[model samples]
Target: MVVFRSGLFFLAFLVIGGAWGQTMATVDRQALAELESLAAQHPSSKALVLAAQGHPVALVQGRATVGFIGLLNADTTPTAWRTWAQAHEAVFPGACRHGVASFRVDANHLDVLEALPMDRLELASRAVPNLDKARYGTRVDSVHAGLDLPTAFHGEGVLVGVLDWGFDYTHPMFYDTALTASRIRGVWDQYRTAGEAPDGFDYGAASLEPWEIQLMGSDTSNVYGYSTHGTHVAGIAAGGGAGVGLTGMAPASDLLLATLMVDEAAALDAFAWMQDVAEADNKRLVINNSWGLPQWGTPDGTSLSNVFIDGLSEDGVVFVSSNGNNGDSNFHIEQTFTTAGDTARSKVQFYPLSAHPHAWGQNLTLWGEPGEAFSANFMVTVGASTEVNQSPWFNTADGPFMLEAVHVAMEDTFVYDVVAEAAHPDNGRPFLQLRIHKGNTGLGVALQMTADQGTVHAWNHTHLSNDVGNWGQDFQAATSGWLQGTPAYGIQQPACGESVIAIGAYASEYLNSQGTEVGGSPAYFSSHGPTLDGRLKPNVSAPGVNVESSLSSFRDGAYAVTEEVEFDGMTYEFAKLSGTSMSSPAVAGIVALMLEANQNLSPSDVRDILEVTARQDQATGALPAEGEVEWGHGKVNAHQAVLAALNWVSWVGHPTLPDNPTGEDLMAQPNPAQERVLVSGNLSAQSTYRLVDTRGRVWQEGPASPVFRIDLQGMPPGVYVVMAWDPELQTSHTTRVVKTQ
Candidate 1:
């Protein structure tokens, strides 16, 4: 469920949104086309107050609706409408003439959307004057040590667009000023013409905007519930000028709010539209799209692609979307995101390794079979397997960890911590004990819904205590280290996102609730990567736990949690939300800062900054793969990224060779020798050299190049690298060589 700030929905609902104030009806193409043909007999469809994009006025067939919903088209002449209606008497019969389907419309209609004009939106730099602040580095650890919110990605100047639920733009935490036509630049709502829902809300005859709701309802003006998701994400991107919790990553970047409100088809079109416009506006835009179909299938049709990504490349936009908390279940993925030729990474989750063994079954049970039918039972409690003395040493032996079974019950569908402890057997180091916490609870009064509501999410109270790979088969059977999605065969989500920085989730200590500088470990549930095509995703990681940012749910008058604040004459509460969905934007904000420092850094450079600056995962003990999961390069380190952005290094991702090799030197003469090339020593008896072509085809091979020659007579002229492998001495080297006349 989308979260909201304390005591704030009364007013929010007044505005308008999905399902509540909308309607859907499929049109009859055959009948409608006939009506259009008649309407064409007139001047234009617009003349009838309901025109087709290019059709003319005089072609009419009949009226086609049962009650209040019917089509509205033009009639060239009053009598022609009757003449056409007479011909199609079979289908239209009695109600024949007027129009086919008509949804009531006018000034007060909910469908008369007050959509922010697409062309009217502007870039963000117009608002925050000090937007370039982060570009100038200030000591992070010494003065502002903690989760460095500001450092997550400097955003004083960059522009970011959020395609999420919706936002309460007026919130002070979000710099609504930046969202106006003048501030951060452009703002639009393609789903609305003047901000209206399909079915108008009958609030005593007139619909009300959230502003109007504030006057009549009990909702707070500052913190709204329900659709405040966009607002919260926006705050994380860049909110400023007040409060104590934390500031966002890019405090000055402009934001655009494009409402979807159940129009999935139209929204995809809008995504494409925005890409083109942002580029035209000279804004190197980054998008935060926290949505996707609940399911994905093979590329059976380019249907979804044409509207969302057909011409995205020329626009140079990048995006990051959620990998759905639904995890493996409900997530039918197997197809991958592979284009004939495209770049930019896409990311998803990477479940972590937990120390406890029982965590495996527990974790899988929750995520593996969502929407599946199953049964449950309990095992009887028994005495310690080996009866010990009645002394303290006697082993209770059964607990939350690995152990013999005690009494187990499935009284409730609730999942519990599978822990083991020593009980009553006295001092026998405690025996295996299975404790049962009972009942029907998950996802809406059930353990499932409760989990989705973000109440004590995974990697928090619900996941394994240790990494799953710790015990190998002792825990579970071996599978490739790849993070595969379930029903793994068709197109997976987000992987289809074109250039947006698709990020996987991971924890970082560099950002605080307010984006302050703090330090910590990685979040466990963040999506892992090496997308379908094997590109490391999740541009980078940022602190996504215990985050302190703007409040967008529950009202101020609502009950206060551990800490409380008052706003707009009300008091409310807050908590930290953790997920890769959260981390991606944090990085977006950081990228904004990088650009503010140097506008020349290409999107590729921006990507490299995050990857190269990453500190090797201290826990994983290996570098992230160039096209695999686990730490993508490593947990992001802003200081390092900033350094590389400053050209303190030669390139991104990895450092340039130090201008000289570290050890003994090896050289090759006539390197690309067509007939045979001479090689000198970097000696080791077991060393091997293989001449490989671009397509990975090896032309010749030999052991030890103390002074050997290679013949490549039939090979084409090109550039290649000679790889030297040594097994006995455990050494490897690579040198560039050229060939041809």
Candidate 2:
């Protein structure tokens, strides 16, 4: 009886085990070892570890102080996490569900989670870049048959958003002809800590009204000398030429401003709020980003920053970003090692004469293909002695190789972290990221890296020896031992996203004292690209060289170019500045014009239209080739784009329709119908009209008219194919109608 009972108990245990299934979670041994090492070294430094799935912790590992920003990916809230963490004295500064949340948990309490699991831990990382005038509006207006045409579109009813540094909202260039009202709808200064933040965001101050913006000039603290940068960019996009001599491409468009933050995460929050506000107001929005972070990993459009941009673009929000200004540097390389024992190496020297001295605190990064069976190491040489930091042979995991003062001969002058792993696992390639912190080394240092197998691509953001002056070049020895003639793939983040439109600078004309056209060419500083993941960027080029636009009223003396005229009774300033920054806004303003033409267009539609209608450079007489690095798709032609949009309405119809088209062309006075559309041209007495969608379903049908009014007041905002048939003429007409709120 006892034996039988024991056998029955064993059978029951197996049955219960099958029902329960496997419940063990995966643990990151590498991260744990790195954290333990960090605790052993810096006992007081605040360290934030990430926890993905709830993993189990054994004990307080070491004396090193550590904190955790538990990324609750499973199912939890910031409040709930805070409550649990607070039980052990954890602090919660903020939380973001749209992207990721940041929190802090003490190191002693960190060991309490013996069963916590996590995927990745982002410790932290830390763009002013310098574009164009005239030609944008000229091309756009001319493409539509000149500005004199009866149907002139100046971006009315659309919102042009500028995410930049300083802005002069009181400038007359942002005001109407009477100067009584400002085109600027709002301004959010993220640097200011004393005022109300934008809705849904905890940081930054807000100026909702134009009067409130003008009042900012007196605040003293908010008015900085840097205002000229943002002011000039805004003017190029939507200035009314009140006090400024040059007019923007979309003078009638509304302006929205957001003073930028240093971190991309903050940028994500700002974009989210701006987009939410625009959607609530039912306004078509276009954002111009003139800044970029070069230190960020891979221009493959897969970073968290690009992900946020993708999210925003899905909602019809357009982003125009600068490709960057690092065209002529040996900052990038790609090498392939076929021999089993062969190794690829590079020497990155941080010249002592750099404008940004102190390379000890900067990041030095490299990325490689995953599962390519590669090994990497870097030897840091300062003067006579050499210290090497290399990865373990054939290690599959990425790392955070921190170089402390005691660990190496160099003390206090600099510290850095060398890491190698897959930045985007979904992309099927691994990457190596190296960041040197507290880099105070006054003496120049050299970095030499080697990979065992496969292709190893490298980039050095900290070393800019060849970039001695503005628009400088180092063609002869820039690449040295690395591959040459592939300066492409240097595009900045966010713009690398598939949806964003990346703009580069092209010299519209070189002017003499009398503004004579001497010559023209692509700007040397315009960054080139076929992004890291191999995507052709800088969707198009625009005039950005020595372009004059509005300047800040707050900028005094040397800030203003005496050679350039200041208009608006000298109340506003105008200055000539150049960079991809100028070109970005120029393209954005042109996009605003496109949006004004067709509000139902998506991000892809806009990119395709711009590429198809772009004008070939007059100097080269060539358009951008399939994968041309610089001068992407040639210079922008605004008029052609708008005309293409108008033609697209006849061919592919609007984005509102799915795939099927059962409607014929019917002439409407206004293509983008706001309240009502008047059906007039090519109408028959006994003609009938039917309105359908891409789904092949008819919504409304009525008698065709020489003078007929289509009530679109109650219709949702989208594209509708209007088909009209005349029994007498035996003709059917189809047209696309874009409805707006």
Candidate 3:
């Protein structure tokens, strides 16, 4: 019985930035000691401390100042203060129940204390998700669609390890009866002695980063309850099904739970306990993590060196993580933020650079800013009444060298929705004419503004501002009605990082009474992609609307994505909240299905299948922007994907096979070119293998190697095999490679 819990019925969350190849470094034993010492300098100190169980304060500073703990407590609660102690009972009766000690500051005096790794504290939100009902046409579209449940679960003997905060072991869904001795099933909790110490992962030793969502506490057992982020993410991996809630991608698959039980958010291993478990239960397969930190904390790539991240991958785990919603809130790829860029426009493009030499009090140029969320080449002119109207015309004097828009055209613009763009629009061409948006923080789209009299340029620190150049000139200044947006200022960089897959939101065809979906689209908050690395993140698109999922049972028990939507003349919160987070899971689930169809399919192989097989029918009927740098391949096609995984007739150098992949006749693509494909009329590449598909798309390409061979996704299903006449890799002798249909 715990008296007071900072966050009950909820567990910690993790961060998986775009580049997940990193993790925490070795703790400077000296640094840890010094931090502890500094934290506990004063006898009255009540600083946050590291403990085996959940973090508990031994002697809280009480209210303000700051103190620290010198040791990692592992014993039961002390009865020094029987009165206060008795009031708070341990939530769980176990060894690692709770390790946290809550108290204010002991004194305001300065006290040398040990400093745990410090990171900026912040909360990130993703674009709501939705299903592609148009492509699917139904909830269970996979049945006859590109990839279905059975095909995806081909990896019945395979495994997937999930690293996150604590889970709800007692939850009905997690306690699937069909698992126990089944071919694909597992559940374990190193944190709690009983039940499933659902959350927390391997944070080596007692090291935790400041911004880390979870921290080491005294009360370890029964620590986590219902974490929205963790639960939602895990649900995508393997959440229990539901009558009203959404089912998981692999409803029948096994689950390996690892939670990082720490207070601070960024600790690599909240404690070695979780790590020890994962190592002992290593299955050499796939692992997904939907957690990461802001790009600012790691200007360099050092953060990608976390030992745990690599160790697991080395042991045969395909690590997956969220690309981060920091584009707007934190240092994102686009220059525009939610408080600024969200508008009633069809597009929300990305900007590359954001530089305010004199305004930001610095000369550095930020490259990860989010800009417009629309078409790069789209332009429009409107009267002062059109919504989402924007014109470069702001300048200093408003506030250093900054820039702000009062009425890009109109008001009420929300999440790319035309909430209020008509306010300034004219009959066709209004006086307040302007374009929608431009630029990505990574790629740096710019607006060279020069103070104009009426629609001049300007800048301000406030959340809202206007174009002030024309303000004082016309005399009627104040009453003249500001021609907002046109900035008469300097240059604003646009299109910074343009090489990656920058994702956008789209709604599913199926709509609720409120026109919502299980996972809808144009997620109001999913930060647009296209990183400073010029890599278009989210390579493809998915539904980002109202998706149904398991509830926290603690935090907002209602539907997850939206507050509530009207369906069939009735209001319901049974569906999940919408966002890219939801969309990503859908894709992840599909990937699992693809693997299930083929045991030999590798991560790369799965990625290729999805990209190539995905449909590219935009409303414009335009093919998906081809290229590995952008759209990768196209929209996901469960039907085609399942077929390809089953047919298993493909090539490595290119996506398409030669005209006749038989044993004799042959044709060459990009014929007489540097890189060409040899389509042997005969399936005679000289490789031996049989491609079998139980449910989803699966294949055995080359001889058995940890990694598999591949070209890209988007392969159609058919009966034909590939014979790789190339080298037999490890064996010096000749070998036969085959691909079965």
Candidate No. with top TM-score = 2
Q: Say which prediction, candidate 1 or candidate 2, comes out ahead on lDDT.
A: 2
RMSD of 1: 20.6
Lowest lDDT sum, 10 consecutive residues, model 2, at 11-20
Q: Report the C-alpha lDDT of model 3 over 1-741, residue by residue, as the tens digit.
A: 112212111112111121112121111121223334544563333333322111122221122222121111333342322233234332111111123222112223222111211111111111111112322422335532324333334224345555555343323344243423222233333333323232332112222221121222211332333344445555655553533334565555555554433221222222223344435554334555444322111221212122233343333334444333322222111123234322211212222124321111101112111221121111122332232333333212211111112222123221110111111111110011112222221211122222112121112110101110101001011113312221111111011112111233345556568965443223334443333333444455454455555444333333334433333343323335554455555555555555566655554455445544555444314442332222223344555555555544334342433333333122222111122222322223343433233222345455422222333234332433333332343211111111112
Over the stretch 1-741, how does candidate 1's per-residue lDDT look in tens digits? 222332211111111122222121111111223333544453433343233211111112212111122222343332443344334322121111223221111211222222211111100000000000121122222212223233343454566776654344445555433333223243343222233321211101111243432232222121112444555566666665334445566666766555432223323433544564566667766666555432211111122232134235333555544432322222222212133222111111222324343342222111112121111112212131111111011111222122111222222232222222222111112112111222222211111111111111011112322211111010110123222234221122443343445554444445446977544454554445434333455445455544544555433333223334554555433435555446555666666666665566666556655654555544535552342353455555554455445442222242322233333244555432446666665657768887665445667778865666666677665544466666766666655444533
Q: What is the C-alpha lDDT of each candidate?
A: 0.37, 0.59, 0.31
Question: What is the alpha-carbon RMSD of candidate 2 to the true structure?
Answer: 13.5
Give the number of the best model, judged by lDDT. Answer: 2
Ranking by lDDT: 2, 1, 3
Residue 3 local lDDT, model 3: 23
My TM-score estimates for the predictions, one after another, are 0.44, 0.69, 0.45
Q: What ranking emerges by TM-score with the best candidate at the front?
A: 2, 3, 1
* Native RMSD of candidate 3 (Å): 17.6
Question: On a 0 to 1 TM-score scale, where does candidate 3 land against the true structure?
Answer: 0.45
Off by over 4 Å in 2: 1-133, 136-150, 218-226, 357-362, 379-416, 422-428, 435-453, 463-486, 510-518, 560-570, 618-621, 624-627, 649-741
